[model samples]
Target chain A: EPEVTQTPSHQVTQMGQEVILRCVPISNHLYFYWYRQILGQKVEFLVSFYNNEISEKSEIFDDQFSVERPDGSNFTLKIRSTKLEDSAMYFCASSEIADTQYFGPGTRLTVL
Target chain B: GESVGLHLPTLSVQEGDNSIINCAYSNSASDYFIWYKQESGKGPQFIIDIRSNMDKRQGQRVTVLLNKTVKHLSLQIAATQPGDSAVYFCAETPITDKLIFGTGTRLQVFP
Candidate 1:
């Protein structure tokens, strides 16, 4: 079965630095999403991308956060300035339509 | 805030017994519901899903029950095994399509 894939399984960055998490959703998928889960916390929605534009976002997806599908296959989330609280497991998911969502293994971001 | 939640935070069951994990969602506009299982270090893995039109869906040894009137969802695992130990989460999505996840329930199966 085809699955979503993410790069840099784990990352360590200094506070105030910039970080970008990358993901390649299932090839035929039309909708892609980003989510984060803090340690011992529930996963929270960050943003959703469709047609190379942001369809929706959460409060946590402030100005500091941006998502880009620079290429037809790559979806990237960039944090202009990393805060300690930004450290979490970031997941990328995609669906062909609006129903079932397939998730990637996730990228663990650690900001110190 | 409208969100998906679980009635129990954890459940313990014997290896051969059946286990049920429950979740409650507050959004009436939600048309899609999914059950996911997350291991200690992996991402949420899709187990089963039920659309608003359906009340029940079964997959392998797992079954998903949806009660639209009550806006509740439950996942039942039959013959629970030690490998079933993990955190299970229920997520709901509205027409906008962004998934709102619930606080997961940790299921422990003792052999």
Candidate 2:
């Protein structure tokens, strides 16, 4: 079965540095989303993208966070400046319609 | 104040035994519910889903039961195997497609 794929399975960055997490959702899917899981916390929604624009976002997706579908296949989440609390497992998901989002193996972001 | 949560944090079962994981969601408007399994070092994998309009839905060896009156959801696994051991999460989607996930339940299957 086709699945969502993410790059840089694991990343380590210093506080105040910039980071970009990349995802390639299923080719035919129209909607894409980003979620994060703190080490021992529930997975939290970050943002949803459709038609090259953000549909909805959470408080965690503040000024530092931005998502771009630079091309047809790539969805990128960039953090302008990272904070220690920003370290978490970031997952990308996609769906053909609006529901039943399928998730990708997450990218573990570590900030020191 | 509305959230999705599980009654148990961990469950253990023997191979070939049936396992049931239970969840309670507080959002009345949540019509879409899904169960996901996450193995170590991986993301959540979709298992099954149930809409509020239905009471139960089954797939393979898994079944999902929803009780809108009490706002409860449960996932039942038949003939549980070692590979079935993972952290299971229940998620609720109220208005939009944005999913709000619950604290996961870790399942351990012994052979």
Candidate 3:
């Protein structure tokens, strides 16, 4: 089956530096989303993208965070200034519609 | 506040037995619900889903029950195996198409 793929399975970055996590969603999917899971915490929604724009975002998705579909297949999340609290496993998901989301393996971000 | 949650934080089951994980959702307007399994260091894998219009749905080795009146959902795994060990989560999406996730329940299948 076709699956969502994420690059850089794990990343380590310095605090105050910039980081970008990349994802390639299922080819035919129209809606894309980003979610994060802190250690020992529930997975939280970050943002949703559709029709080439952001549909909704949570408080965690502040000005420091931005998502881009720079190409037909790539969805990228960039953090302007990383913080220790920002370290978590970031998952990218996509669906033909919003009801059933298929997730990628996830990218583990570690900021020291 | 979280829109969905589990009744138990952890459950242990013997191999060959059946495992039932329960979740409660607060959104009366939610139209779709999904259960996911996440292993260590991986993402949430889709297990099964049910729409508000249906009371029950079945997949291979799994079943989902939805009760609109009580705002509850549950996943039942038949013939539980050690490979089934993972953290399970339930997510709800209202008509607006935004997903709200629940706190997960860890399942351990003992040999």
Candidate 4:
């Protein structure tokens, strides 16, 4: 079955540095989302993208975070300046319309 | 303040036994619910989902039971195997498609 895929399975960056996590969503899907989970916490929604624009976002998605669909298949989440607390497993998900959202393996971001 | 939550933190089951994971939601407006399985170092994988209009839904060896009145959901796995060991989370979609996930319940299957 087709699945969402992410690049750079693991990312290590210094505090205040910019980091970009990339995802290639399932090809025919129309909606894309980004979520994060702290080491032992529940996954939290970050942002949702559709039609090349942000459709919805959560309070945790602050000024430092931005998402882009630079191409047909590539969706990216960029953090302008990372903080130690930003370290977590970032996941990308895609769905067709209102169907079940399929998740990628996730990219582990380690901010030091 | 409304959120999704699990009833248990961990559950251990013998191989070939049936396993059931329960979840509760405080949001009355939620119209959809999904169950996901997450192994170590991986993202949540879709296991099954149910809509508010349906009371029950079944997949290969999995079944999801939803109770709108009590606002509870449960995932039942038949004849659980070792590969079923993972952290399972229940997510609800209240208004928008963005999912609100619950604290996961770890399922440990042993032979």
Error of 2 at B62 (Å): 0.2
Q: Against the true structure, candidate 1 has what lDDT?
A: 0.94
True contacts kept of each: 0.86, 0.92, 0.86, 0.89
The parts of candidate 3 lying over 4 Å away from their true place are: none
After superposition, the stretches of candidate 4 with alpha carbons farther than 4 Å from their true spots are none
- Model 3 C-alpha lDDT per residue in residues B1-111, reported as the tens digit of each score: 447989999999999999999999988989999999999999999999999999999999999999999999999999999999999999998766767889999999999
Q: Candidate 3 on A2-112: residue-level lDDT in tens? A: 999998899999999999999999999999999999998999999999999999999999999999999999999999999999999999999997779999999999999
For every candidate, C-alpha RMSD to the true structure in Å: 0.9, 0.6, 0.9, 0.6
| Preferred candidate (lDDT higher): 1 or 4 | 4
| Tens-place lDDT digits, model 4, residues B1-111 | 769999999999999999999999999999999999999999999999999999999999999999999999999999999999999999999989999999999999999
DockQ result, candidate 2:
0.94
Would you list the clashing residue pairs of candidate 1? none
Q: Which CAPRI quality tier does the interface of model 1 achieve?
A: high
TM-score of each: 0.97, 0.99, 0.98, 0.99
TM-score computed on alpha carbons, candidate 2: 0.99
Model 3: TM-score, first chain? 0.99
Against the true two-chain complex, what DockQ does each candidate achieve?
0.89, 0.94, 0.87, 0.89
Tens-place lDDT per residue, model 2, B6-109, is 99999999999999999999999998999999999999999999998999999999999999999999999999999999999999998999999999999999
Which 10-residue span in candidate 3 chain B carries the lowest summed lDDT? B93-102
Ranking by DockQ: 2, 4, 1, 3
